[model samples]
Target chain A: MSKTVEIRWHGRGGQGAKTAALLLADVAFKTGKYVQGFPEYGPERMGAPITAYNRISDQPLTVHSNIYEPDYVVVVDETLLESIDVTNGLKADGAIIINSQRPKEELLPLLNGYQGGVYVLDAREISIRALGKNFPNSPMLAATVAVSGVMGREDFLGEMRQSFQHKFAKKPEVIDGNMMALELAFNQVGC
Target chain B: MAIRERLSGNEAVAYAIKQINPDVMPAFPITPSTEIPQYVANYIANGEIDTEFIHVESEHSAMSATLGASAAGARALTATSSCGMALMWEELYVAASDRLPIVLALVNRALTGPININADHSDSMGARDSGWIQIYAESNQEVYDNFLQAFPIAEHKDVMLPVMICQDGFITSHGVENILLVEDDKVKEFVGEYEPEHYLLHPTEKMAVGPYAVSNYYMETKRAQRQAMLNAKQVILDMAAKFEQMTGRKYGFFEEYRMEDAEYAIVIIGSAAGTCKAAIEEIRATTGKKVGLLKIRVFRPFPEEEIAQALSHVKAVAIMDRSEMFAGSCGPLGAEVRAALFQAKSQAEVVNYFYGLGGRDITVQDFMQVYDNLENIANTHVVTGMYDYIGLRER
Candidate 1:
């Protein structure tokens, strides 16, 4: 019953957008908040566009419907902007974060005149610099937390570090890289 | 203390399966429900439980192997969706008729034709008369809790029938959410042991299952099956009460939300009920309308009298169905609920709606519109468009 933060993620099938949404739900739940993470399912293909959603609240969530008017929208794959209306029902006061190095001015036109704040994170650059890979989900997740202020910066970093440690327990070397990517993305997301 | 965790509906059921550690699980893979067997198989491989895992060729063999295990006095279960269930149709009835206490984890999906892999009630609705004690869930937590109770309800002395615990495919089945899980010891103790009174493997006595009843005894066997179903109503309540004592979560044949003094109401089942609840909360907060919802948890042993009593006070009701019966009148739930009201001699105005077919999203706004229609009907005492579809494209 409390105020819920609704988020929608747009990405390709193999992009880990769904994984990022679920990871957000995991961290939020660890903070003692009720959370839901689900992806809009379709025929599975490598390059097909897919959508995922998240709901975080202080109280239990009763609604099982897809988010129409989202408080925040994260376009995990910037190319999806041309094919999908990622901001179809986005709240004007809320924000849209895109993982593009093309600058916010170029992406704004594709959003159908969305008047809310637009945030751009050069996720590829950040990921390559921090982790030496093209994994944009880690940076995009951090950018979302940084832009939305869902949790404090320090708290989000701490949670991500712990999560990475657990996820990469066998391969402990990758934990630091993922954490570095998150911190760099958290600090570098620009309006 | 209940362990706080987060899991998808399939994982939750698999976790419960790990806790109960049934004797045998014969399964074949199907979307939405495939994760269940996959997880259970992982547990077996990891030595988490000693449950026998049977990988069969098809769903028919999966269910046939399950019934074989149950008749041989091993606690048995299986998981399937859509056409897999249709393939198991004959075994479903045999499990009930032969009095085998089998538990089936059913991920409710749309039956094929257009070849869709989405959530709907058609798969389970089509099996309404297959003699299984059907229980539905609106969330992951409910599905987990319902699975824990399925064995107790199905194996009770007076109600030795198969149980189908159904959740919407790709909705609760795939959605991850927060859940409180009972302790492993508590679940094991609650589910208890499945000791059938008669079994084929008995050392001193011999028993035969699936016997061909002659024309003289066929009707009596059916009558006995119906009696078991009738007895299940009370058994379901008793088991729910016991489960509440252990976990502090109350369950019943159905859940009534804000129905005390409501003039407009909606009757629904499965995950959509959660959406309806959200809409009801908004309606009460904004316009102060007395809107309410009746979410059915037990569908097979239809709680006709109790549902009638709950809806008797409402002026107008919208009964929503997620599957089409194509009977030209209403869907499966609509037909049963209308008949229940008519039998109870209630004068409430009722409308049946078909919605959410083939994974079409049903939002709170759609429910708000249904409530608005209910208000119109209650005030004017005239019913317009008694049978209709929600979220349908019309010319």
Candidate 2:
């Protein structure tokens, strides 16, 4: 409420929700905002549902507890909605964004009575077309930024490009594909 | 010229080690603390530092290798968590009694029974009397700053002892936060060159470190080490002051948050202190109750006098311990604080609460309950003479 944006991501261990949260923190930090990004470690294994959290703000943060009331919840894997309470402790004014091919209205019942905005995006198609793989991390991040307005779509694109350049220096195609997927996902989110 | 960065407690410590560029680092991996060695190994691989990264097989070997290097006069470090710390239990005393001045980046983990990889003070608290200069941190920034200060304190001519720069296992170690790092040049200069006066590998000086002493010499040697540790109290303060001037982040034996003119206060350590501060703020704002906190930063030397004086005027106090001492009287922090009070002759009603064992969550609400008990004690001058656990389920 004090200009801090808390977001939680629900996804499998290898699906990059944790990566998305950290990338957002790094990019948001580059944009001159205070940020915190960390994953709750359980018995981590591939395909096991894992949770990652973020707190981004203009001022420094002091509270270090797990985010029980998140401003935005991103379900990086739509299947997580069935097994996990994705909307647990969401703020009344918060929004839940799901990465799915389904319509926003169709996923409304899966919200567990959350009276907030529901947004969905066809992240798989966008990822496959842009990156030639099904890694939806960057797209989901872009979609999260788009729906939450935590970061401007244009600013995220620019920052993501700069970060990806360093992370994928040997493979320019990977950088280009991630950038393209982010932009397409930014456009694809429907509130 | 300090640089602003965002890093977790583990990364911050690793970055400090990167800047210090010690002579050797022999390490093994453990939960929550594994990231520290992993990061340092990466730095060495990238040639950011030329410090020897010895990939030891176990925590015991890690300590042995560290002592082996430090005795040879090469500045060394290693890291471990809960069980790993326990495995190195025997060597902890050797590192101290040998007066090797090794700086250990200990990420505090819970000593297992049911087995836990979470945050607790049991690991470090168990070694509080192991002659290591133990310092606890409440945040990532403190962890970084403390790691940078450790070498100076331990290597001081007066206090030739090992130092453990400890932060909570996953609570601070894994939690990312914004931090200001000192300029690399400034840190390197402050830690300075480690030119040992007498070491096993000295070219001209002949000396044997860590030789078994008979009863005739052991007590005197221990007396000298004890004096050195006592001298460390001032050395630690001096280093903290110097660190403050360089980085503008002042540190002390303890942090008394809003303790002035308070009738009810809670003393705690590490990450849970962050939550307690929030609860204190809420109690102050919503209930008009003046609640304060005394968060312990340096645990080994146990700033008894300063802590006693700080809580002298408070009406009722709650000392929260993340690890249970199981010592019939009280937990470590509680027993120490009670002793400090007895010495100071303060009449403040004090109670002990053992919480967050095995990394059970100690939330703002949990602290709120402690505050309520403090208030009740404040009114009636009575306390429930019972050991308490925060949020522990009774079967």
Candidate 3:
């Protein structure tokens, strides 16, 4: 068996599904795991459903297709639950990280009897407060690493720092602020 | 040593992009071509390849951001399909006419409205008139190889036209097959390091890529662009030959199969040629009849002279087109083939079959059916695909 943890993310075109997946893989690599992050595309117009995936492993991985049954599913937009089936073909032992204003009880039925581990957070509010934007990719990914117990909270922060520093290297403050957002989300939802 | 892997054209495209190590990649995923960008992003994140993968909002922006990166003198690339290609249509033309060497991989799909997500050439046909140099591939290997050749072709000083390497959506892009890749060193040598002369964002160099050519010289500038595109023909042949010598794999503008001593032939492009080859062989064995398959690997800078020479002796030829040029009487490829052979001495009966629109699977048997129809129609009139008659739409 491979030492990778495969993640599948569901969201609309503009909701940063692909970004969140890439950030998770970047963080995983910084923690010394081989990773793969990508997205599935169709007529990916704005507001259309889309999926992005990540594979994190200690060793190299051979799986290169779409994540059919992923180890973790990150739902960036809770509204995707209505038209799109976010939880379909999820691994039995997988965990789902969702962005919702409501608690787990309110969102469980929307998952259609998905019995895997569930961690819910209002990443939208977190993004607005921490970064002054509606982009919840960084916070949601941080919450995922925290809930899934994939890596320590400290290592997750370190990875976020490295990734943010490089991505927005032009804007150090932006990187610093996103790192703060990751810490806040990590503190709000502990593994 | 390079690893042998079973990958789809989309995956091969992703693999090539990874090797190129682009500075920026932004692709709005469309079916057939979606997997290319996805794989590149994953590869970048995993540290398999170091690159910046931008998750752009739309295909138009995907192309726009790639232009931005390319203009900044960074190796930038992107992919799209069907409507996504249409969305990028205006920008794609600008990226080319402005002589920005942006490499784009287009997974060919039918454009929307009837909204078919299947394999076809409609997307590419829409951009055929765009100033971009277009190269078509028939397999996963071709996808990998053509992309390896595209960078140099696009960035060539005399031919600074943007290049679009196209493969059929699901037929070639989605189907998985084993392929032998050229060694990485060979790929690097074949494409060479990208050194931009007039990048937009470079501060030290005072140069411009996209400048307004007014009416007085717009036509002259357009003439220069055309001359540059024509100049690429020899460069492509030279590079493809060099690639063959290095990799022990032969590529050509046209790949002729069983074209010897044939009185009749089938001419088409894309993955459909694979089916035609199989059907021709089966028909020959059973009936001892001689028919050939002419696969058009290069669409633009249409290989008219070679095609005419190849079919000069054949009595009849059938052109299989996956997309229809609605306003015109003939399908796009069919019209081009007929025009190419119009001046040939042999009066070959050329018939056009416009089936398999929008990813409809065209099997070997379908080719045999068309071949059979070609023989009967050679002496009579043209036979076309069944159209929705006045009463057919009600069903």
Candidate 4:
């Protein structure tokens, strides 16, 4: 494992790229890990492409700049693959997890010359099946953790439940569905 | 042992305020710093602390209310960033001239005109001559710790002046990280209670606060204010030493990182120090160059002698500035360090570089370039332009 794990999330503005990045850091902080989670800020609208970042480390993190050479990338909306250079400046040995129904081989063309682990999952279908909605951020986050091995699947699930409980306090059903979707994606992610 | 929590810089400052639980807090919202007041408001509403928060209409009124509460002998505080702080421009001088010891949690952002809401030192640096003490923090922990220590420095008997504790706007203000929090009771004991020798609310003493001084007294009043700021240099050192003993987190006017017997060094401020440290680490690993860093934690009361002494040993020093000073020399920091080195008559060839204006990203390679320039000067001692900008799209 690297001394620090830098993760970049590519997704549309309305999607939970910011949420996933921040939630991952929040949970990491709870486990006594040093973390930084921030979205690259611009005057972005609802559906525009946006990026968020995370720096998770066992020791104190001294780098306060944005992550350019991310160790892992999570593409919450696979549509972003066509436009943004999702693998730009990504480390050669880094891994990527894409939330897509398409096979890993199908997504390989988009990440040319990456030469890294590629994990694919039908995160949207998983979330829709469990939550009756199209939102796949929580499940994509779970997939990210499972594929990157930055943290244990159980640790991710436990933190996801706690985060959802606090965030969706008034909607108990929403919280349960998010938890279910997170676990499903975690179990199903594969290259 | 301290309690550990995940908090953004604003949340950490709010937590410090919660522990201080000062008598009054006058607040108005501005980007980056807006969350600070929001969190404090929530803290007040939740009964976590008993700070009387005055929701003012504008940033000017926020500072005015803070001055009023402080003049009335209450420990008062406020928060603002960028334009909000600019709005309080006139009052910033008043808070210091009146010798009111108030703590302003300033989230450093770019000032208006071309209008960007990102991290820069222009906001606080613009007020560098406003007779207020300024301290810059590099991390969320320093943000919390600096806020706690600022009170003693400003309120000391010899230095009854206002202080601004600044952290990068969205960089530190909105960015989340793990922070160690001092126990509430321990902080309370350390800060103690606010006791001003003279106050507007004093029952037996008839006195004036923020009064108009005639020509005869105006210069002397200004001089007294200047002297107070000068006296604060030592007071800050004393307070930081005491605070370090309490929390095991040492602080000073400036921090020297890996500077022993170094031939090249860079002096920087605020959040960018972390990035430079990373660059220095990488450079030292690959090239084995003897590079070091001198990050100025206290910008005001400039720490001229101390900083000059520290950088005097290096062969070539580059004072990095986040904001532009268009005056041909580097920005404010570069300008001052040049003057300080002149006073010390140090032979180090100094250059200035301005970067990250209006939130431009400065990468590790960019800093490595700065170090390379310094290394060249150290070897040949041929100085280039007085100043240069990093990562600019120049022809």
The number of the candidate with the highest DockQ is 1
* lDDT of candidate 4 at residue A41, scale 0 to 100: 78
Find the candidate with the highest lDDT and give its number: 1
Question: What tens-digit string does per-residue lDDT give for candidate 4 at B1-395?
Answer: 89988888988998899888999999886553468889889989999999999988999999999999999999999999999999999999999899999999999889877878888889899999999999999999999999999888888999999999999987888888888999988898888888999999999999999778899999999989889988998899899999989999999999899898678999999888888999999999999999999999998899998998998789999988998657866799999999999999999999888888888888888889999999898788788689877888966
TM-score of chain B of 4: 0.98
Q: Tell me the spans in candidate 1 whose CA falls farther than 4 Å from its real position.
A: B30-32
Residue B21, candidate 3: how far off, in angstroms?
1.4
DockQ of 4: 0.79
Error of 2 at B50 (Å): 1.3
Q: What is the lDDT of residue B230 in candidate 3?
A: 88
RMSD of each: 1.2, 1.7, 11.8, 1.7
Instruction: Give the DockQ (2 decimals) of all models.
Output: 0.90, 0.61, 0.02, 0.79
Q: Pick the candidate with the highest TM-score.
A: 1
Question: Model 4 residue A4 lDDT?
Answer: 95
Off by over 4 Å in 3: A1-191, B29-33, B201-204, B379-395
Per-chain TM-score of candidate 1, chain B: 0.99
Compose the digit string of candidate 4's lDDT tens values, residues A1-191: 55999999998898989988888898878766889988887776898888899999998888888889999999998988999889898888888888898988888999866898888889889989999988888788888888777778777778778888898888887888888898888789842
What shift in Å separates residue B104 of candidate 1 from its native position after superposition? 0.4
User: After TM-score superposition, what is the CA distance of residue B15 in candidate 2 from its true location, in Å?
Assistant: 0.9
**Model 2 alpha-carbon miss at residue A127, Å:** 0.9
Cα lDDT over the full model 1 = 0.93
Number of the candidate with higher lDDT, 1 or 2: 1
